[model samples]
Target: MLFARRADWKATKPDNLHEPVTSTKGVKVHYTGTRFEPFLEVHALCAMRVKEIQREHMEGKGDSEIDYNLLVCRHGVVFEGRGWREQNAANGNRELNRAHHAVCAPTGSGGYTDVPEKMVRGIQDAIAYLRRHGAGWEIAGHRDGYATQCPGDLLYGHVLNGSLDPGVLWDGGNHIVRGGETLGRISVRYNVPSDYIILANPDDLDASGKVKDGMKLWIPARGVPLKGADPTPGDDATEFQPFPGAKWFHEEPSSPIITAMGERLVAEGCSEYAKGPGPQWSEADRASYAKWQRKLGYAGAKADGWPGETSWEQLRVPYVGQKPGDFEEFPGDAWFHDQPKSRIITAMGKRLVEEGCGHYSKGPGPQWTEADRHSYAVWQRKLGFNGSKADGWPGEYSWDRLQVPEDDD
Candidate 1:
């Protein structure tokens, strides 16, 4: 991992800043908003993006320094910003500022088109590194908890798709109702068919395709790629189902379950996604699942998402952020104590952070060292553990206290 430190990017030191905040939630993915040229070289293009974003955050946004905690360049290099253990000004509100770290990816000259594969990997790597340390697992977009579209549509789809981790708010349909807003108008706004909006909220629409002045709706994402074209579909069940799924792309967020599956796959080290394991099942999921199946000694028809009961039973795992599951081996302190750094250790660290028991100099590193033990010990002490129980290793008693949720549903 080629990590560019603060000096490497020529970032200005934060001045006049007081009482730095720590994020207890997860991370937020931000985009440059404005378009830039496609990256030809990592050093030149990435550095320019870092400089410009920092300048805008400090000068225009009126912050002490850059808003984000890091920037993932298009060539898969992670540029440090406020670094870990500091507050991010880019996360919408003051409370959210204290809850989440911010990371930015550049979408370049055409605004939210296909971002480079290297850049997407870099973003995921940065998130993994943060998860290894002490960041929470709730990955979100800039506009997820805020109003403005700072991360754009295409990139935000990945955020919804669980690119970083779990707790992604499903996208392409959250909109506020305003005065004179009709089902047709809302459909136009989100680029979805009016029929989708009607299906998302049947009771809210009027007979003439009108809408109440103050009725909120989950407008499914734009189905009709053809702008100004008739979205009129025959009254059929297939027409009501959101995206045209005669074909599926790995790049779009379509549903909640797909996002959950993607998150689990990412934590399991199957990152074949460029955009999402978001709302929709894409080529990424198939490719990732195929790798997993390949690892599991499966061949031919026993690959990808089409799995039998035996495959499902064998591929069990504990969700990092979502609801916990019945794993044959629950990753506990033994998995972390003196054990090598891995995804299990990272998940445990994220849970530790959520419990407000992190105490590492830099981060909850992937390495199963003294830091992770001490952090868990802190939480154990909070649970009134003493003597052997407070030895900084996770025990069932303390693990239960942490209440790691299982994504059973």
Candidate 2:
């Protein structure tokens, strides 16, 4: 029988495809315990393996066709097997037969091994195809859904950690930046606060506060924080005290705002020469003025590792025109107080959507579009918010956004 080359394998459904199964719960990935003698011959071997599976199902096991829904070879070829609509008998458990689709990876050995780039891509494509077809599935290793270690340790590790899956692949996490990566773009891509990225790698600090490609700073695994420590000044205290000389912006004094604002100044191309109010400015009226200057991008604002006057002017206050409690109805003042939650801005609106802070409904009121969800998910992951099912919703994890420090440098 003629076998199709792995390279030519497309994700098309078979002409005799069955109706798609409904309510897919998860995916089961396997590793074929086979090795290719020569790397170049791997694709052919993979094609042959597909034929073997079909033969086994058709004759030996007395089944209709291949038991697996898809197969990926070391060469990165993807082959449609039983077809997702058809019930697969690959796993011994009957419950999984109705809710899971089986995908197999060609393992060089029975144990841990490096999956070829091609094969990894093929697996990602297969998963993407399945998800697009309304499969309510999360990628899983065979060990997750079955009583077997069929996909092996290496593959299993990626699945458990939520890495090397369709989401990361299709969403641009696969690309490696050499040096030209700007913190703004990276912040938008990963939905992380740009300031946090700079804080993580002060050495990457450019005069403009953005990281350039080939800068060699570590992109913390998505959802991992920079220092992996509290960004807030006083973790032990509930109420925040004003830094000496720094005027309190609010009567209660919000620590999160202080840290988030400081980080934002650093990201918006602030210079390091700027001076933070320090403990002195903590209670000074000029502190808010300093923050306003940093936000406005005043000249000389450098993330140069120092908060100075140039940074202060950039964040210069936007002319509130009225005192805090004046009943004259200052729209600007209200806008300032109701600035859509500073945490929301720092975290990015999209990130808020991912955290499920707002509903993803068809209309508005905190609902997000597909692009919004996708972008925010990426950003949330970059900020080390990994494993947070909330994605961008304001929850306990998002509270961490408030904990960022003001003067860590």
Candidate 3:
């Protein structure tokens, strides 16, 4: 939480070129985007880099000062940019700039994609500093409302999961219930255990365990190191079934995975199936999942029955030998028909054989052929697809459902 003044970086005096902004919605995190060299961890080098960025902003974009409100270096030092006195120009457009204060990390692709713990703490400190200076409670990545991936994948993951939040004290506190806020949502926001919160606030809950608006509830802090109970214990490393894309559901795919997911939904009291929660995707599965989303406080387009990453993670569907993020992304429809020869095809062919749909009499070779097509058609049929939908060419949805291992795997 060390602060360096604009004078510390030898920054130019305020030109009043940037507009005045006393308050903002929250803070948006950004990264260097380009490669950030490792040698720049030195304090002098970090200051030099900040000065370089300021010069780039002044000369290239014709800005009055650095576009960011604050800049955090890898060594956990917070450098003053535009600071709290002025609106930042880094959040894409004028409207966005007015809404959020921008905070840049000196981490990016190539050179420093994985941020260190100290750097994470530095960014957390930056957010805390912003909140103290009239910024609101929201915290988002730069790519949230914009087009480009300014914060990159690693940091954006932290932003989504609340890892970058300057968490409240874990000792204990009274929290006034906000409108539309549930115990589940509150636990996520505070990084506390829901069970612990419920145990602490028995007086505030209704007969069915729902909290009313404006109810004052006790929030027990995590990491108390008590003898008998640990509020947040280490999670067992269990494998989770990766979400086979939404298209897989509409195609009526039949697999053990489907039955597992249905069983989980049933356990959660969200089952809508009239008969068997069987090894097949049906309209019932969609309806049941919609109920699950509703229970989670989602509505409108968000509760459309299709699985999103956030909802899927919350489902905690037991793994069938694959982790959530380990699956390969779709390589595009053109990759299959381009006469390509690669191990990815071989892996896919092997999976098809394993699924008992291999139509080839010879080898499941790396190249695409009629046998491969016929074999894939069998797979499509196995998944309950038909006619034009079972055309044998790999669609992104079916490909994802197939869970074809990457060449590296």
**Which is the leading candidate under lDDT?**
3
lDDT of 3 by residue, 19-60 (tens): 888899999999978766443443434665677678667765
How far is 52's C-alpha from truth in model 3 (Å)? 0.5
- lDDT of candidate 2 over 127-196, digit per residue (tens): 6655655455577777764677667787777677765465541222223455576667776675443444
TM-score for each model: 0.39, 0.37, 0.42
Evaluate model 3: give its lDDT: 0.73
What lDDT tens digits, residue by residue, belong to model 1 across residues 55-83?
A: 76777678888888888876666788887
- Candidate 3's C-alpha runs over 4 A off are 169-409
- Per-model C-alpha RMSD: 23.5, 26.0, 23.9
